[model samples]
Target: MSEALEQVAKNKDDVAANEAALEDLFCVISSYNPDFERDLITRAYAYSKSHHKGTLRKSGEDFISHPLGTARICADLMLDSVTIAAALLHDVVEDTPSTIPEVKKLFGDEVAELVDGLTKLQKVSLKSEEEEQAENLRKMIVAMARDIRVILIKLADRTHNMRTICHLDKHKQIQKAKETLEIYAPLAHRLGIYSIKWELEDLAFAALHPRKYSELQQMVSQRRTDRESYVAMAALQLEKELNNVGIQVKIEGRAKHFYSIYTKMVRKGKEFNEIYDLTAMRVLVDTVKDCYGALGIIHSIWKPMPGRFKDYIAMPKFNMYRSLHTTVIGPQGKPLEIQIRTQKMHQTAEFGIAAHWLYKEKGSSAKSKEQAADKLAWLRQMMEWQSETDDPKEFMKTLRIDLFEEEVFVFTPKGEVISLASGSTPIDFAYAVHTDVGHHCVGAKVNNRIVPLHHTLHSGDFIEVLTSKSSHGPSRDWLNFVQTSRARNKIRQWFKKERRQDSEHIGREQLQEALRRKGLASQKIVASPEFSELTRSMGFLKTEDLYVSLGTGKTSAQQVVTRITRDMDSVPDLA
Candidate 1:
């Protein structure tokens, strides 16, 4: 037993020394940013180590090791000293007796705020274990709205947790796996952090569907040799083809991960043998011109599959992802997927948000900050959706709808590209353009042809929304077709303001008829001071609000009458 314990400790030390020593983290960050504050990092490490000493995780490893590992990941992103400090101190407030105030005192205000935002997530109260998996999702989103660093820290924390999930019990493992799939993985994808996003997915899939995961893993393993050989042969041919065109390029082959293959299998309802593009050939070039040149060459080499091409370089994703993709016939008669991008784009593809920190050229840091702010503008949009309803569950429902969608890129009349969630309609497009445009929109033309408001937009379609000053406002029917929460919220807001008077008029008529049926006078009820109280009891601040609810089918006049009768019955003979 003693010998085994010594061996385990020795192995742990060896692994850490080789790959993730404290000095390695320092050296990596210094290489990226020559002006970084190494002294501050060392102090943060000592402070976090002191606070977390003597604690042990479920794996029986020292708890301080978790913070150290998280900080190491932050260093890998080439983050600043403050973010790395926050990563080390993130769990102290939630786990230890220390408070946010102490973190502020010890680490300053910025790091303290991040730690506070993280600790707030530990207090989520959900409906049930099964139904409320995304209960804390809204809270994290709201926190992200305040500071994008909050989520970056939290995502790093979650990555470490998921990496060590094997230490947890089976029941807890399933719970965490579901949470990661439903929330963190999608969040990472939205942030364009594919480095952690793909790993989180595979880890969760392994835990949640152990048998299926093992089966797919074995399948991938069995095909490793054949796929490598095929990819090698294809790379050589592609390199020669590009070289003849004088477009200097580097070719690499990437095997698809198990989770992606499984997703393709289920999404397309195909077996492994039927799945095409098991391995993607990525071509890196020097310039944007060379990217398109390579694409044309790849197509000329192999017969291009119809509708299997996407030009993301021309129209980058909202998260700033860019690549040119095409599927074509290759050796072994297999459909090969090829991606072409510049070297800068390839870095962005791999590191995503971290790419901004990886280079320290002049003006790059400022540009990166501006880009980070732009990317997190979606957090403000999520907050806009949250403003409509207080129910975290409902917010999460809409959030999931937005999160799981594949992107669709459409164009404006002027040729500017507008990216939206897949399945978005003309109304969603109009709203995405502007709230005022959506409100006054009377009709739309897609590709110079008139289409209904509910017309689902396909990629590459140019959309023109026809507006009229005489148009009253958005119709309630638009809700039935609008897909994005941004569009849905804007439409609901228009009705909530514009239709309140209409709702009140309709509600008053409905109330009068109900009063007559109950043999009570409507005039008397409105004249009484108790009317506002009656509306308040029904969860409305004013009678007009009650009427608006009635008009929207959210409440009925009959229910109001029943409440009135109960109130009257409670009164004594003074009535």
Candidate 2:
């Protein structure tokens, strides 16, 4: 066949495959949302296919499959039609000659905004990988603050990419896997999407640590055959007991993901055989009442281990996870783990914030919006911290801390539950309450007993931050013990604001000395409007910023004077 004819035939085949994929995606959407707008989604799919027609992924599959995969993930999450459409078109504005305005004109503002949010800053001239990453995250966060669906789409896109990542070179694969493990997986966990989170972790773990992943996979496979009969017997016993109590239940055994198993091994310094809860049995009931009833029935069957019973149903996790977890001695005298929850709670536990869409009705968008706001309060707090943080490295550092830290649920004196990072001191707690409260904090008492400022906090500790009218401000020592970015950023901002005047004074003197050494008219240049213009041209908001930069030794006196000599049209007479 002629080359042109072969190329045309390939395009035709790609289109036919993409159409089949679209049908599968639509079926997923209709399974949950029968009333979804098929026209809108079809248009988006066709548009994406048209734009990305000739392109191909590293795996040699047509590029349209990538968007189709991403959109399917979103549909599986039971996301709205607009979100699924945005997922399809996310890379169009970025990779193709298509523009945002064109998307907006065709799809409306909502879909356009979401696509734009997922688009990276490919055109910007970033100085470093860190800067580019930080800026890209900054853009996504801004869009997320406006609409949380932007992040949902981004997560779906990332999940799809991670699925096909093996097609790339080994170095590229490892790099992408590390990034997924460090950022995207944790973000999914925070958002409470365990389905995606578990997949991302396992995929990244496999890519980054192939040998360990293989060994773990082999271990899990070998153990599965041995444990099948044990799990079946346990399920039968639980089924009989639950039936006797007149509560309907579904029971299944779930294996721990490879990365989670890896984390447990490293954290406890134990081998796989030493891990008791390699597989856990989940009990799903029809109602909350049945959830507790099943828990009782399970406890009656086996003795639950102390310090292993967690009642998350009463006190749900920040990520909206609700369940009754217990570790018990099961048949044959081996330790068995069990989680009991209602079907609705299971949905929330599995899907996190995305489950909100599954339960949403037409007129309840206002309530859903309110629920999303409450669920994503941490995202807003992150935005505030990032805005105050100027350094790209600092932003990424603080972001990782926020994303990775395990939560400790503390309380205020008034009994309001306040969540902070584990190992957080009273300083972090005070800052979490309010910035002013943090600044004016004089002392702290945990559970009505006075504790030192650097004392680490734990769950259920009632924190009382005592403030005095005559208090000076936050101590510099607090930064050493503080675990939250908010506390650290606030402390740094305080010092910077307090030292600005001194820095400006020192900076002015340095510039004058430099000019005198060069035999220029120092006083005349200092007083001239030309100097202010030069400061503005140097990317400073005002003359004082340039002075402060010089005073802080961030910009040397020689560099500033040299720029001034070169930029100025007229030079002052030599002294």
Candidate 3:
């Protein structure tokens, strides 16, 4: 047997002794799956173990345990065998000498590609860590173009890593944990992966401020018994009432996550006691009509807090999450949040993309496919956006600003729901709806009020963008006001095509500023290989053509700077 395989066997025996209950739990969960595909999973596990054989995690456990645990989590999500396999081997490429080719030979191309997508690039001497992070994000987006499952597996791997972060040093813990909060957690939330999102946020918060985490944990623990009693009483009453109406619904109550509660405290300046909706109940019904029926029944039993109700069923979230949410004053005049949704919505809310496998297991392949397509649309959009720009820093910045920012939902004239970033203006909305509408947008009417084109859209606002037949296209200033990258890119494309002189002028000014920052003045940069290579990579046939395109306002100043700096290593040192 390989040394790594022997080590893993020994580690398994140790775990069986030290964490017997957890081992039993894992076995029970694994046993429940009739189609475990044990051979594929076992081989992948052995490969990971071999790659990380002699290494011990900061937690003092064998490094292989982390990947094994991550794979188990993916299994719990009911992901495919390939996804579970990929999860098991995710860290091998980055953490060990194992290459993508080796992984492909061991597993298959699909698994290798998934691992490559999840792998972080090797450190280079040329870039700062922040620049490296931006570049890594850019590479991940490029990889995402191939298959989205890579991202899903990466998220699961990150979630598991964050969960066990307490084993690392304080500095490393805080760094990794904050990254989880700032990036991975938000990404998961965007993908509707609430289970991963909540865990990531909580663990990150714990690592960043252990004192605060502990205090909050203690405070919540003290109220646990009372909270359970109150929830039980409420559930009993709700069940009795719904049962009387012959409404078959399953109701359960849960306390808000610590990080969620902390965010409310920080953002709204509220005390822990002042957060009224700490404990909430969710009702899952069999059908859409039953969901509404359950909501009506719940509201009949308690008075709802005005303006605290939202009907997401009519206008679902961008991630396709649907539910009827209401904050109500219960029996003791205490506020409680109630969520009503169909069983399918419940599964989607809990498992997100993984719920597709759940449906497949139940022989609902059509529904599974639809859900997968809906979830994968964001991946396709990311790929599309990446194709429009070659500057990795700018691409990363635009993606972070567009995808991870807060979102607001608006409606078209036909009542089709459109979601944009929270501060997004009507111009952004116009571009999101259609590039043509945005290009010729003359004015906007938001909820029948004649508002400026720059008016920020709010949730539930019925937006109508006025367009002119005369192709008086998008204003240059609209790019500054627009929140989404899609709108910005389209506007740039329009200028690139129609206003060469203006684009060239803007591009020249941008390129000059970038050159100055890099200590290469206009005269020096004109002959520099860096400048020539940048333009070439940007698809310009000639250096002069590139300069003229920039001078004409066809592209962004930021994009010019990014490309130059990224290729700085190849440039002759002006210094």
Candidate 4:
């Protein structure tokens, strides 16, 4: 190697070494907390460094740099000292010789417990790759339910991992990138951590769909100058207008991320130029009163598109994201998205639950705890349902379906608001209320108008479930229609124990009928060698279990038969 090239490489290594940035993190954490335990955190850093003595990442950088970056991310959230410490040591037990007992002795039970949670969530292969991911996600969610900090630290860890993903094999990069986009990004969004959510989506997008991401990146880059100029003009106009109204405002322009644009394109079937929010602006101001005032001034300045305004501040989202959004007709005959929020709201929107500590708490710890419990109730419920649901594939499907959905807000008869995934029926509403309510649910009145059990709920609808003591229980059809895991489980549980013979008989009958329709016989199909493989592939133990699953409404008979037929076709003369 040439000396000049070696010197340049040394400089690059110096740049890549992130220890100096970690020092900045130490200063930031200590700045907010003067008496912060600098020694304790530094001790964790020293221990992790010692344990990861001579490791390197696929990026050819020091392995310790990953955890250091993760720790910095945690510090950016202004998390508690213990959380930051755990972030520093998250990968130690997984990748190094460090043990949980050692972590406990060195860092105390709190840090050790968090680290154990991360360790116990190791990805285990079930029957297939899908099953492995589902089981892994289940464990992670269950752990997250126990302690919210687990997910926060995991997000930070994932953030650093994705940021340095370039060093990985192309296939692994695509795999991790897809996982980040499909799972972690939504998890972060569900937690209301926009700071993590937006970047994770973009990074994952870049890795998974490199050419498309590059195209979008270049498209946005090409418009950067014009967009910046428009935003500058708009900001001056809006700031001046708000100032005239005795409101102080800070304005900034935001370019929508590549993944967000790609999602819009795919979901809405829109082109890049058709995305109105690409060139957007944010107006941060003092006081909620000023926030609303700025909105009024913005509306006066430009005509707002009808129905484009969402008052998230008045009714915060399930993740506690608070801001007011609107779309206005802007200077170049283009639509502009404008978000108005107080400084506190902006902080909370960015950091999510972490902001609770960063900003001074408005309520007592007891109230904060109550709010946190409310926010994580859905997660706890999903994890609890995992044990009740027999099929891990079904459980994973339900988990993903329920996790990323937009919710509808409904009012109970007593006027208490309940939030549920959009498209959830009144049966889902009853189950969301309670298991007994769902089990006993016979009919419902949506908005005081009597409706069937399958009546789809909408935001602002008032629902009253009518139960009868004499009612037999949930119908099997509820499995086909009910949108919540809780409701589905309650119904599945009823049939699972109520009539095994009847369910088995029905299951057999259904499978026979399906086979007959396909011009095949049930016995011949079941006796085939591929039948057991088919059952196992479906996450069933035996043919009888598959029948029972079909009868009990845990799975589909037609779907299973269709799969069997496809498998049979793949091998000639199977029977």
Candidate 5:
């Protein structure tokens, strides 16, 4: 065949392949939403394919493949039709000549808005790369705050990128891998999407440390036979016991992911062989009662290791994760980890908010959706700090702390479970309960015993915060021990408000001193038109803002004086 004819044939083949891919995706979507609009998906796929006609990815695949893969992921999560359509068109406005208004005209407002949010989130640059990354993170969080589906699409897009990341150069691979490990994985974990979180972590780990990844892979593979044999033996024994107890159960074993195993090694300073519970068995039952009954039966069969039990069903994690996790001695005296949960809880444990979103869409009430969304108070807290925090570094620091910290679940006097960062103090708990509760807190009672405000709380602790209206608000000392960003930020805000006047006074004095040194009358310059323009140019709305910035050490007095002199020099002097 002629060259042109051959090229045309290849294009037809690609089109057929793309259609097959979309057919598979449609099957997945129909399983969840039988009435989902096939026409919308078909239009989106064709629009994306045409827009990306000549574009190819680094992996030498059609650029259309990326969006198609992303949309499939969203479909697997049972996301709404609009999100799937947005996923199909997410890169169109950014990478192609298409614009948001064009997308809105083509699709509807919901898809256009999501595409716009993803577009804005993709563009971030500032003074340095670190600042740019921090800014990008802030943008993603803000976008999520507005519409949670934005991050959902972004995460789907990232998962596809990581899956095909090997096409990039070494430096690019490491950079993308680190970003995924640091930002995206944690976001997935925070959302309680373990399926995505685990995949992201393992993929990133492989990219960032290829040698260590190979080492761990070899180690796990080498032990597969023995592990499988042991798991089968344990499963059989457990099945017999549960059946005897009249509990219907399905037990399955899973190898711990490489990233999690590596984390355990580094955290415990142990070698691969030194670590136990390399495999975990999950028991899925029909009811919450069966979950407890299975846990009891498992414990009766094997002696549980000390302090290795976590009853998350009684108190779910901040991300709405619930399971009864325990490590016990098993056959051949090896440590065996097990989790017991109802089949419904198992779904939530794996799919997290996506499962809730699916529930909300299946004719569930609006109130049910709100209840699921209320669990994401962390997202709202990020928005609060983003508004208050001007420094990108500070915002990223708080974000890292919030994401990476292990959780500790404590209870209030009213039997409400409040989740705080591990090593959290009573002040953190107080703020978690209410800002007023934290400000008025004078002392605390952990399990009915008086304890210092700085005492580090443990799980299952019943805390009672003692407050008095006559007492002063939070102490500067609380800043030293508070763990949660909410507690720390609230304390700083209190101080900032209380000391604003003093800061203004000090800042004015510093400026006047600098003016005296420059042989300029302080009052004349302060009231000058030049000064008004300078303050506005310096990003202050009013003179008090300038003073506050100076007092807070955010603006140096010398910096202000230098700007003033420079502005004066630029202007023509009037006689």
Candidate 6:
């Protein structure tokens, strides 16, 4: 059969599948909305199909199937009609010649606006494929300024694509997988979509490096039968023990992700057999009190691993993920991590951002809704940052640093908890709390130990910042000492506005020093077309302006040097 014919057949199958999925999805919606907007959803799906009629994806599936899958995921989230409609038409403008006006005509202005918000700029070009990808990411962020739902829908589409990426070529598979790992996964994390983020990472890791993927998969699969049996027996025992104590709990087991396993192996230099807690049992109870009550029962039955306990219920992760993690040695002397949480935490863990819909559907308490809303604040902040920053490269850089970094939880003297990226110093924490705290920071106390402000905080560390009124505001050097982009950006903003002359002077000296180390002075190098073009390509209009921007901390020095070398390599030598 011809490729086009195969695609048409596949699309027919997809449409059928989507109908079933949509039917199930409508049931969920029916519980929430007495009069579900079924007509609008049908119209959106029909419009998507018509818009993408002749187009086939690299996987030889009809392009419309992608949008339908995205819409199904959105509907599963119980998102508003506008969001679901947007998901249906998200790729119409970007992948097809169908205009926003066409979408507006077919659906409505709200749907069209979302489609436009999700569309990528078609005309921008960059010198390298990597640069082009980065620029495309920036364009996406810019589009996010119009509406946050656009990016959310795009993320869902990417997740579904990654799941089915095996149909693409090896090269394309790796490319798409890498994009998912670097861009879409991080975007999902920032949006508090942990389930999507985890799956995206695991799938992308599997496709990009099949050898390691299969190795870990085999290792994980080998013990699955035994692991299931152990968990079942343990859960049964725990249930009876808890039931005798008048406590109710739901217990289940989950295997760790391949990427997560591989990461631990690489970091700890441990073989697969050395890694304990591969399969974990989770207990969900009715109330927070019950969560602790269940935890005590588990500990009474099994010996808990020393120093392997975490209470996120009191001080949750930045994403608002809450649970009590305790590694305990079970009946066989095998280490097993048991997670204790309330039913709310289980829903958040499984559905993440979609938990909002679940809560709304069930008429959950106001506290539950507020908890979900509080977690979404980060997403709003990300959208705001994208709006305030015009530099796409900067936005991408900040996002990469934030998304890929792990976090540590610390506490203030009054017992208020603060979360910072792992490797973050007190300076990062001070800045995270408030700019004034960072600016006036003189010293820090980690667990009451008088430490320098650069001390990296660990979990459960009680931090106290020592401030001096006579002390100067944050030094330019503090920027380098901080781990988070939030701290670094605030430092730069202060220097950019408050100490312009000093910043310019320091920036100039730094540039000259960097050039001197590179064996190319500004006088000799700035005159070269390679250098000038490199600066221009990096978004600076002039070579001196580039240096000044670097000095003022607006642009990164390393990026400037790397671009110069790359530009020089591309220039034809005339000996």
Cα lDDT listed for each candidate: 0.80, 0.88, 0.77, 0.83, 0.88, 0.76
Per-residue C-alpha lDDT of model 3 across residues 1-575, encoded as one tens digit per residue: 99999978977785564355334424644664666556777788778877897798787777877887787777767676677788889899889999999999988876787788777533444456666666666666665455556677778778878878777788888789877887788777777778888998898998888888899999888888877788788889998998898889888886689999898999999888887777888887888988888888888999989999998888777666889999899878888888999988987887776666651332443455465766665666666676776665777678778567776888998999887878999999998888899999999999999998778889989999999989679889987788888888888888767766665566676777776776765656666776777778889977767767667566666677666667656544357
Q: Lowest-lDDT window of 10 residues in candidate 1?
A: 566-575
C-alpha TM-scores of all predictions: 0.83, 0.88, 0.81, 0.82, 0.88, 0.78
- In angstroms, the error of model 5 at 372 is 3.9
Q: Which stretches of candidate 6 lie over 4 Å from their true place?
A: 1-35, 120-124, 127-147, 358-397, 447-449, 502-575
Q: Tell me how far the alpha carbon of residue 337 in candidate 5 is from the true structure, in angstroms, after superposition.
A: 0.8
Candidate 3's C-alpha runs over 4 A off are 1-32, 97-99, 120-126, 359-371, 389-397, 447-449, 469-471, 492-540, 543-575
lDDT of 3: 0.77
**Candidate 5 vs candidate 6: which has greater lDDT?**
5
Q: Is candidate 1 or candidate 5 better by TM-score?
A: 5
Better of 3 and 6 by lDDT: 3
Candidate 4 ranges with C-alpha deviation above 4 Å: 1-18, 357-371, 500-575
Error of 5 at 139 (Å): 1.5
Instruction: Give the per-residue lDDT digits (tens) of candidate 4, residues 1-575.
Output: 99999967965674456568668878888776666667778888888877886787787667778778898888878777777888889889998888999999999887899899988877775788888887888888778766777888999999999999998899999999989977899888888899899999999988888899999989999988988999999888878888887898889997687887898899999998887778799999989988888888888889999989988887788788889999999877788899999988998898887665453222343454456667766777777788787676787788778678888888998989898888999999998998888889989999889998888998889999999999888888888888877787778888777787688788988988877777776777777778888889888887787888888899887898779778774433324
By lDDT, the better pick of 2 and 4 is 2
Better of 1 and 2 by TM-score: 2
How would you encode candidate 1's per-residue C-alpha lDDT over 158-268 as one tens digit per residue? Answer: 888989999999999998898899888888888777887888899999999989999999988998888888889999998999899899999988868778899999999
lDDT, candidate 2, at 389: 86
lDDT of 2 by residue, 1-575 (tens): 99999988977887788788999998888888888889999999889989997888998889989999999999888988888888999899889999999999999887887788777534366999899888877776776677777888888888999999889999999988998998889889988999999999999999999999999999999989767778889999999999997999899987789999999999999999999887589999999899888988888989998999988887777788899999999999888899999989989988898887773534665576577878877888888987898899999999999988888889998899998888999999999999999999999999999999999998889999999878878888888899998899999999878799889999999999999899998888977898889989889999899999999999999998898899888779565
All candidates: CA RMSD (Å): 5.3, 4.2, 8.6, 10.1, 4.6, 10.0
Clashes of each: 0, 0, 10, 0, 0, 1
